[model samples]
Target: MDTNQIVRAVKTPVTLVLLAVLVYFAANWGLDAVRKPIPPRPPEPCVVQQIGPELTPDHVYVRVYNGSKTNGLAKRLGSVLSADGFKVVKRVNADRDDYPRSLVVGHSEDSPEVALVRKALTNVDFMADGRIDRTVDVIIGSEQPGAAEQPDLKVPLPDGTACLPKIQTVEVNE
Candidate 1:
């Protein structure tokens, strides 16, 4: 073949190869652009239910009344208490009467669970007054009328550990 024809033949093949590469990359990019991404699912609701209030001397039924307006702290407290082997008998939204965010230990009498409740309360900074008094049954403070205006139990916690308050019985005014 002549020099010009030979050069033209080589150029034609090179051009075809370049065109094929360009088409392959363009198709790949276009397919990727058109592909749809999957969306994420919503989170599950928190498991906060009344487990019941009946206790033995060794196993006292502890109920944490999370009457705070915000649920973040209450949820955290519930999870922490449950992890510590305390069975949360009930999880209720605070009514007006449930104010002062009380922690009830025994249904009729004081029990060892009262101490555990007290310890847990101290860790929570928003508890109105951490009381472990008898005659009150198990009543935590809520934001309600006639609720005792006591300061929150702010016990100092060690590093990487939560401080739970000590439970003590209060005198009832008859």
Candidate 2:
């Protein structure tokens, strides 16, 4: 064969092989781009809810009456009881006739949890004239000292006075 014919034949085969390789790669890239991705499955729902015992052993309910004007003092007492591992509950700032100012401490009816509540008197600084006449169910009523003032147990009470021991104050913020 002549030189020009030989060169033309070799060039035709090389161009055809290169075209085939390009077509294969183009098809592969096109298929990958067209394919869709699988979506993720959702999480399973919970079936049961469990009931547990009280977290704290002690529960306290404090009632500071309107006439008492000692909300800060009652809050301080609540913080103290809570610090002592007690679950403190507040029921205060209510009408004088409906809720008397007295501390009501008792055990939970459902569980063996002890509770203490302090209710301030209408005109007195102490609770219920400092006389807790209840059956002493978890130290029913106790006179709470002034939140800012220290208690003097030996201080003589005025005539017809009620007295309760001072509970240790807890510095909640500190």
Residue lDDT tens for model 1, 66-125: 565655444555555566555555555545443554444332222233443554444222
Candidate 1 structure lDDT = 0.43
Clashes of 2: 7
Which candidate leads the pack in lDDT? Answer: 1
Which segments of model 2 are wrong by more than 4 Å? 1-67, 97-101, 105-111, 115-174
Q: Look at candidate 1 and tell me the lDDT of residue 153.
A: 23
Regions of candidate 1 where Cα sits further than 4 Å from its true position: 1-58, 101-110, 123-174
lDDT score, residue 48, model 1?
26
Per-model TM against the reference? 0.32, 0.26
lDDT of model 1, residue 145: 16
